[model samples]
Target: MRKDSEHPFRQFENDPGRHALVELFVREHCGKIKDLLRDCVPLAKGSFGNILGIRGKAATALGLALKEYPRKYESVIAPFAEQQRLSVNIPSAPRIWGSDQADGKDYVIMDEIPGVNLWALPQLQELPRAARLRIFLDALGIVDQYRKAGKRHNDITPSNLGVDATGDMRSFDPDFMSDLHQSDTDRFENKSVGSPAYMAPEAVINLPAGRGPHSDSFSMGATLIAAITGEILPKLLGENGVNDYFFYMLNTEKMQREIDVMLHEIIKDPVLLKVLLRLLHTDPAQRTVEPELRSELESGAADHRTMRYILDDYSPAYRTAVQQWEERMGMAGEQEGFMRTWLRRTAISCEKLIEFFKGLRNV
Candidate 1:
């Protein structure tokens, strides 16, 4: 969830003229929800819709869509939620309580995330560096999980991620979820998927392919950049002012310059910088080269020796990040073992990464 101030739908509730419309909408939906809900309490409104927390026996929250059945909730939203439950940060996906049509509006109730989003926290920089790094690792873990599953979380941002009481992370947005239903042609033809600030260059420039795991990696890297520098990535990259697609195409050189500056400024560790650059690469293929990476690995020519090379010169800061992350994950005294387990489970392939870097070098 975003900050209340940035929540545009909140204004409609406060505006004397627009307030009636919101109330009418909520009232009609509430009628349907109350029939199936107990101890319901109004939470807040967002641009997409409003949310409510269910007390008593439910011990959950509800999300009411402002729009009509945009996609098949049972197919798209429901399954996605179930799978996201397997995410590192989120313990379980919010269950779809039910959906109903009222006054031509549709509403659905899903379990509420019980934690504070990263953006809601004050003074993130003040948190221990290890703590901050853990956040990045957690986000990375989410991306890695989805990538291995050959799925994608189209939108990822601090505001869309939450930290529960157990210090685990969760994804809060449901609208942009994609099951990659489109064919190759449709994927290439899809438009921008989520927030622009964290979008990858391919998302801005290329149209033949839609945002994928690499784009997720780029957003994760941007989150890390924000964590380290305490500055939004777009601002740090001097990509602040203009967001239209044309501006990105017209200023390719300028964008590279911004990336160079950002890489130099926030990332002191060479290994981390290298990894981040690869993640944010302009060439979508170069970023991860999903097709190539997966294919080459399957061929077994490179022997899956990619990651070892990239981590050959591991940075101390990254070591610390890894150690801290492992410890927080309850592998405090088993770093090596935990890493092995993690590597096996992670969708990110070091061998594939090596191939990607090699291709970059050859180019």
Candidate 2:
């Protein structure tokens, strides 16, 4: 497949005709459309459509966010909106107020959830490690709920997530929410549905079997890494760029090494590092948020050891040994005997570390 320099949904923003159509629809449906549009602020622009924050009197009285899409997506957006409207209220998800079709456009009015996007939250990195981990675990729980309900957010990114005034995490932009039960023909295939930077490897490559809850887990893992490191997945993938990012994702060995290096740079807790690596496993079948792990995180019952403390108090010597062995192996020449000795030593130490981490999985 060729590089997708531009997602098809982006065209809606650039099409003069589509803009005119949205303007016409607002004029006909929203009384004093000019005044209302004047007060509306651009909140976000995603692959599927644009989200505008309703401000002034309309916003105060209605407390709604306006999301619009080209009429061509009516079949997809309409059903998804209606499903959200009827579903039992999911506390972490934005409520869909209603949907309408007119003038070659489909509009969804939803609750304008209060608070900043996850990425924009102030002092996020400065927060305690457990606090930061809680935020993401809560976010992951929201995704898990959607999965249990036979729905998939499809697009899970830091920008699409919010931390409400109550400190609860809420997922935004439901325009790409999809039903897992929907037939393949009705689904948005391939890379057309998600944010390129955070999409799952299978979704990025448009695999034949399609995506499921594990796909969301992969995105969540990437988001977790971003929250901790302040670097997006593309940046973590390095100079080879996004195309290589996708290629590396499909190659398990390379993906593991990349994730290990990135996480090790910022996260010192071995258990946390292992959990993240599992979530980001290249194979969808192997990627998951373990129930025990999720429960501990969500309940705030998990270990609250600080990153520095964890490194200092828990097996620092073993980690140091592993690091030194790796460095030596990297600098070693092609002497078979020298290489074999360090390789065996590194493998044994890594196994002990892995066992130590495994014992802490429940902690």
Candidate 3:
């Protein structure tokens, strides 16, 4: 029986760009979606794709399509609920992977995330680079889990990041629908990986391992610099933006862009530079280790202290960001009854956090 659309998925059509993706979603999957998807409200679609609200396993179809790892993708997302471990200021539902419904065609299911777009960070020119970098760093943890399990993120950029009112960072737009194939099944990246604006220098060359962790790291660095500075490096670095990889690396003009001036600083910072540098390296073998990447970031913690005056400064965002990092890394303690029945669950972690820091003032 077609149950009343009481579940959250019904509300998904209101999501931006998702409506369009649904119309095209027909051919991608092997079979048809049983969910009676109503008309979806359209929003501005991203450069490559659209978004949609789906119930059951169909909700995750777009995501699972991006990479061929149906089973491992399930394996990677399974731990998120336990892994995110947010006490407050969290999203209502656990986005952690579990099957709600898969069309034999899709293979895995994902929960629908509600609330606002959570994409306001891009507009704030005064936001701290470190704070945004913090979000990207946590994102890396998720990416790391997938790679170890043999998965890849087809999209990585500021627009893909979701930040709540309480400043929680979550990943969305798992809709890499173009990568899924009818017969293929397993981890593969025949399609271009992630976005171009923040793509690694190697990405222009279409290297498989080109952007890996380092590529992600470099893009994160670029995102941070752009967020704080309102500047963007030439996506290709130089001629490499068009063709020829080795020559692009050796080109001096590529390194001298207005964006590169500050980018070079991050690329040079003792603690921060190595993270971005490894991501920018021409060879995949010279990747920056993830754990060590964050540590190097801490090595430059004082860099944020200078920017404490701005509304977007790291003063408060830094604290929340660190807790988020701890949550992603599983360093934070588990709560007694913290089942993510509500999005506020994430916020609860943040609230408890505020109290803890507030209490520290008296002590």
Q: What TM-score goes with each of the models?
A: 0.56, 0.65, 0.46
Candidates 1 and 2: which is better by TM-score? 2
Off by over 4 Å in 3: 1-36, 39-49, 53-109, 114-119, 122-125, 128-133, 174-194, 204-214, 235-262, 265-274, 289-293, 296-363
Q: 304, model 1: CA deviation in Å? A: 30
lDDT of each: 0.47, 0.57, 0.39
Tens-digit per-residue lDDT, 35-101, candidate 3: 4233222222433333344423333332212211233334223233332232111232223232223
Q: Which of candidates 1 and 3 reaches a greater TM-score? A: 1
lDDT, candidate 2, at 237:
68
Kindly report which residue stretches of model 2 are placed more than 4 angstroms away from their true locations once superposed.
Answer: 1-39, 46-49, 55-59, 72-80, 86-88, 181-186, 189-191, 204-206, 295-363
Candidate 1 C-alpha lDDT tens digits along 1-363: 111112111221123422222233333445565454445565544325556554432121112222234333323333433433433233323334345555444556554443455555533445543444445445555676666656566667766665543345556664555543332235323444467777666555655555544667777666656655667777775556645543663466677667877787767655446556666666555555244333332342211122112221223332343343333334344413433443344333455445555655797
At residue 136, candidate 3 shows an lDDT of 42
Candidate that would win on TM-score: 2
Pick by lDDT: which candidate is best? Answer: 2
Q: 2 or 3, which is superior by lDDT?
A: 2
